[model samples]
Target: MATDKHCKNELAAPSADQCMDHYGCIYENNHLITLMVDPADGSIVDANRAACSFYGYRLREFRKLLITDLNGGQEDDTGSFLDRALPGGKYRGNQVFHEHHRLASGQHIDVEIHTGAMRILGRDCVYTVIHDISERMRSEKRLRESEERYRDLVELCPEAILVYSGGTILFANQRTEKLFGIVKEELLGRSIDDFFIEKPLSSSEYNKLKAMSGIKDSFRIEQRFIRRHDRRVFDLDISGVPITYNETATLQLVCRDITQKKKETERAVRLQEQRHAVGFPLEDKAVLDKLYIPANTLSGDFFIFHRISDYEVLGIIGDVAGKGISAALSISALRVMFMDSLHSGLAPVEILQDLNRRAIEHMGEDYIAGCCFHFDFNRGMMKAAAAGINEFMYKPGGGEGMRITVKGTPLGMFAGSTFEQTAIPFQAGDRFCFYSDGMELLFSSDELCREYEYLQGKIAGSVLQDDCTWLSLLIT
Candidate 1:
């Protein structure tokens, strides 16, 4: 027979009476609140020292209360717990549940109950070890809230961001669904390469040693992708950022769509090549060496020299108001109109008026700054006029250069616009030049003086210089 004295030596086939000494030792010394309750009525039969103190009750007082009473009228929940915990009054299994327990002082505390079936005096009893888990539960809830906030922030990001390790995707933001056309669940755990039409780095180019040294630059590639839902092809500019996520080294891929922009860039290059073919090549005259370096694909400035009679040549220089395709197209239309007027041998003033009217008719409302000069070699006379362009410089053989005035309102503003011509008697060595207003902006003060000196040298013999210094908003 088992005795309390024998328990001090060794636990016999355990029963409440015989194992009381061993059980009492554990009950007295254990940190957890413990109790023995009759499985039949959920009533407490025994209370450990910790349980008595934890509930603000003495041992005898704690024993009279039902376990369900401590759990705040949770008889049904307690019954369900017992069904799983003891299971037929014969099981030695344990079960755990979170429940609120009331203390003798009327304070409520959340506890984690770990219960097991025990035989005490040949009857079924429930042995429970309860841990106060209030703080731990609160901490877990806070962690969940923090993670939810982070997810909300990332979901609103415009760029598709993804984290992957070992070639498999671990996380993706909300934009991944729109950008890649795959739901977040479907994207997760899939091979990272599955979405991209373009593969990642070449095997030889991937250097583990450099990556470990933190010297690895993030790799970027413009690649095509197959959208998962629509299966449509799209372009993406992807950057592979090496990072540590969740304490593990991984690659975060950030992608942007550039399919439309990519095609526009390609088309612009082709148009730029064709744009260079517009201007004419002059027969090399000792006085002029021409070079046009456009700031972009097209130039807003253009010039032409057309021979009218054996001894007369019409020199034209013009600038459209702005640059690019719109300005280039306007210049083209104006060029055709001006040439026709010049061929008809219209006076410089009449040529300006005719071209202005034709330009407004064909090109709609537009701004043009232009100068046309008719130089007669045999007659030794020159006639020049402009619309928007006001004056130009002239120098004669053995004479100082000075500005010659010929003014008109810019074309296309109104039908009543008028033009005036400036005529001069020419000598064999008299010269003039026509240029765009942007010419001055391209040069600094010292550069301008230096370039003017160079131009003076080129025109020393039969000189003609155009001093068109119409500075507006003054290029500083």
Candidate 2:
């Protein structure tokens, strides 16, 4: 009702004919105390009837009083109020509720005031409406105390908690600030992305998280964050929770720094590497062509080539069960045992038996699939032992390819998985190819077979004769 009367007055000029109609209207007859002040001197220019009655002063007495008298002689108070309520900027809403004023009776009261600059008598002046807000101020003080108590509980929490909005850090507790090496004041206006080592997040990821169902519960993310001082790397296990503040959506982040544990893990990996280097360089002039790619940093595939005599060569290729550094070390131990047995002049079958015995002795329950061959160039014969891996192909005297079939269980798989030795005759121009499962696993079985056939056709016309290596052996 007050707003409607105010609008009518704003649309029509005041005249004697409309004076009686406006007398009891809500705008001119509101209970709020209204005052007009001269901008040049902070003097009380005019006071409405309600203002005169509310401040316990007559209109004649109020005209002689300066506006500063009601403000308890704070010299800069008037200047601050004018700056906030000038033509382009005016104080609005509850922001005006914090000002304190004294009445003519010298009794202080908390008041809510709305103010704006307006033209009066062809000169600039300020118009203000004041409302008593003593009960509202008391309620607000109690609410602030409750919030302070809750904040204290949040600060004492062990988990690192942070509140953020509009990409800026809003609030952080002691644990969070200490972990990040930042002060509360310093982090307030800074973007949260500034503390991350990687790109903060894609727009799609942000939207996905915002739209996720049941977001109030919890969610986890693994990310990299930068330390505040030296910018060192740290891994963060972040838990996000959604909250509303000031009617806007905000995120509460709980982060755990895992830098020390990560460093210890890396150190343990390097030590494992040093221990597995015990069985290096097993043979000389054997031309071992090997390519290793581990799903992890460590692998379980193993290969060894050794010369038993000046005219005889022994080759072994195997893949151990499982993966990781432990499996790789197991394969290394098996290789050492096989090399030791071969150097003692053991037959192909006996060598496999001894290797299996050693594997059973050292390995827990893991097993290895392998094939071994002893080639004698002088006698033009080859002795081979197969266990688990039996499919083989050879080209004798550079003639048509032939497949050799041998059968046995993998070593360490059973208590006594025996192996059999098979012999094959060779010629001067014969070529032999040996491989592990990884070689076939490089491409699909069909793709690899097709590539192999294509390589065979290419080799027919090529004159390149280089030492046998992984890729080079395919060329003539």
Candidate 3:
């Protein structure tokens, strides 16, 4: 019975050699410091070679102590590992840093302990992995401090800084929000076009920005934007820079609100209009009527009458493409060219050809349609040259009218084209009307003929709805 009892005890004990053989492979090759601890008394049950080497201890020495002996806390403290590994408790990312543990010879080493709960040997236990991250932690702290300093600098910047990514405003500085009259929360996740009253920047501008990819020379432009609070238009001078953040390309914009400047500009335009109305009266008796219509705040159509040597008069009517300030600028340039060519004593056809050549040279590719008519009263003849413009109407008596056709293309188009000059004998009570296409929309060819017949016998006032100038000369 004694032998049988000894045999049963031997069977109950685990084979140490077999257990070592099975776990030796894991102990030698594993990177993590794997350890198993007792659940009931928090004793060290088993530790791999990695754990012994990481904690500055031999496996045999570690087995002699409880898990709490290695903890920096006192023996009664129970340590954080026991608390986390209790049945039904959660194992969060709990870590302890600079924890000192004793070795066999009483030497101490600093370590970082990461703990999690698991089952070991068919019982509830705590598994821990140790790491020596003292140097890595120092590096991370320095990087975080540098980032904070850079953030502070950006916050104190005076210019309105806007950071955009993927068509949404990701970040905005205090000045940016204040200029747009919107809080940062509202501005984020919104597109730049949301506040812009004018059209968004053109595709060409966007392409140019993509090509530049850095700070460019300052360019001045007028922009219209709406405030969030009142929806009022505010002109702005905006500058932008390109930057890379988090491996993504983005744009940073700095804006200045120029509302006062816009107000001053409008006031100046009104004053100039008043001054022009006062100084330049429509006083030429040869001009029966004139009309002006601007497609926008400014016009591209221009008409002028110059009394050349009392008997001879020159009338010019022209239209440039586009609208607003660009067209206005082109018209001003054309006015200078027209006056220069006329004063040089060139014939009507020669004057138009010279003007076309100069305009093409200066404007480059953009063209304008115009007509010049010279009425030589002393010779009883009216000579006119048309370039790309519609036919001119010459009304004789008894509802008879003839159309003068253009023989050349619009100015600024071809390198060389001939302009045909047509001369008509000036008779008494002959009416000549020169106008833009805007006038033709109101009167068709048949309707104009009827009007001319009606006007042959009677003097009647006509309502012209376009930019028109009619010169009716009655030879005595």
Candidate 4:
């Protein structure tokens, strides 16, 4: 019944003749926020009911406020807009302005204002319509910030990153410039295929890149690239992932320089082969047992034994400075020199002096830590000399084990560096052990064979930080 009554009232709406009487009533009751301002003094002349509600101001209060008060000083002088509203001016027609407006609650908001010059009752005025655009402005600001963060991440990445389409380069990060030895300006808009020496993208690789699958869907291959300036070819490990760049389906590539790693790997293989070829010579000697374990693919440690006579064996165990290829090379050269001195019939002390002189002349900054010894089974005597390697275990049969220490500087430090030699009588059933500093020996046990076995097992299971080599002899 109530709905019917309201419909009947709407159908009996005012006639055109009576609508003229509601001329001011329409403007006052309109839902759009509207205002009439005194153009001469920038004062508010009138405000509609919508303006009052939107600004949280009473009609009487709005009439006393200036347009600048609501505009937050955006227009310091109202003439700025009036000057543009004149004929031949930029905003001669209905003018538009984007501004920040201050609300009655002291909050600021973005707004779009549409304004027009008007005359009412023989007085000039400016009619304005305001639209709140605060939400739109906030959304645009967030989008700009997100784009800035993405650009920063790409530029600061350590590995070379690039985006390409159809073998053409679209984007390359800062690291890419350094990797290719080309400036950023030169890298852009270039063909990505030109940089690689390998064949261009394959059909399967392109298909995988276009799939736009998850991260796990990417593929990696080892490729070769030549520097733009030097033209030096180097190895690269590249991973390609399907990505959408600039709203287009494209590929993102991450490249890492693996040239040095490949060289080191090959060098290590060669060093291991050398060690295998130079196997322990005295391993067949019945009274001698030796163990050697390297810390890395290449070792700085080495041991050499030569049978000088039927009852006399000359040997040296040493460690060179540094590791990897350089140290391994040094050990290899040292072994040849040791065999020469052993065949010359030089004593342990004389051999150390000769080796020191050679090391100073040839090794340069490199140094050697070594201990040389001569074992005479028939005479029951042990003669040892020290250079950096100071102490070794010596135990007589049925006697307490003790360390024999002879002080000397490591070889190659000073020219003519003297070494100390110690002669200890070792009879049948006595045991002598020569080892590098890498091994820690207590010499608390008289049973040298058992201790040597235990040390070997322990060293085998442990992770060594340095090369460890030891030789044990049981005089029998």
In terms of TM-score, the best-performing candidate is: 4
TM-score of each model, in listed order: 0.46, 0.45, 0.49, 0.50
Which 10 consecutive positions of candidate 1 have the poorest summed lDDT? 467-476
- Compose the digit string of candidate 1's lDDT tens values, residues 374-468: 76666667788888767666656666656676878777766778888988876655556455665544433323223345634433432222322
Where model 4 places Cα greater than 4 Å from the true spot, the runs are 1-286, 340-345, 441-452
Candidate lDDT scores, in order, read 0.66, 0.64, 0.65, 0.75
* Alpha carbon deviation, residue 72, candidate 3 (Å): 24
Residues 1-476, model 4: lDDT tens digits: 99999999999968665664574787787888998878777788999988988889998999989887896655533445445334254336688877788889888898888889877666778888889999989977876777577668989889899887765677888898778777766777777555544433354543443344444557797765666456677788888877766666777888888889778867776765565344334443336667677778677777777777777778788889988778867887787777665544568998998888888888998999999998776777789999999988887788777878898888888996889999998777787888887775422333333565787777767778677777778776
Tell me the tens digit of each residue's lDDT in model 2 across 403-458: 66788788877777878789887765555555566555343332322334564454
Off by over 4 Å in 3: 1-121, 125-170, 173-287, 440-443, 446-476
> Lowest lDDT 10-mer window, candidate 4?
440-449
Candidate 4 total steric clashes: 0
Segments of candidate 1 deviating more than 4 angstroms: 1-19, 75-81, 105-107, 120-124, 163-165, 170-174, 182-188, 199-253, 260-476
Give per-residue CA lDDT, model 3, range 1-476, as digits (tens): 99999999988856767666765686557888777777667788778877777667787877787877876545334435566455245455444434555555676655566666665345766676777665667666676777576557667988677777666787778777677777777888887667654535354444432343444454445566666457777777767666654445766666777688667546644542452233112234243533454434555667666767767777677777766556666777887888888756647898888888888889776688788888777787888888877577777755466666767677888878778888888766676666666556665554343443343322224443333322334333
Model 2 residue-pair collision total: 0
By the lDDT metric, which is better: model 1 or model 3? 1
Root-mean-square deviation of Cα positions for candidate 4 versus the true structure, in angstroms? 10.7
Weakest 10 consecutive residues of candidate 2 by summed lDDT:
467-476
Off by over 4 Å in 2: 1-194, 199-228, 234-297, 343-345, 441-476
Candidate 1 pairs with clashing backbones: 393-467, 431-463, 431-464, 432-464, 432-465, 433-465, 433-466
TM-score of model 4 vs. true structure: 0.50
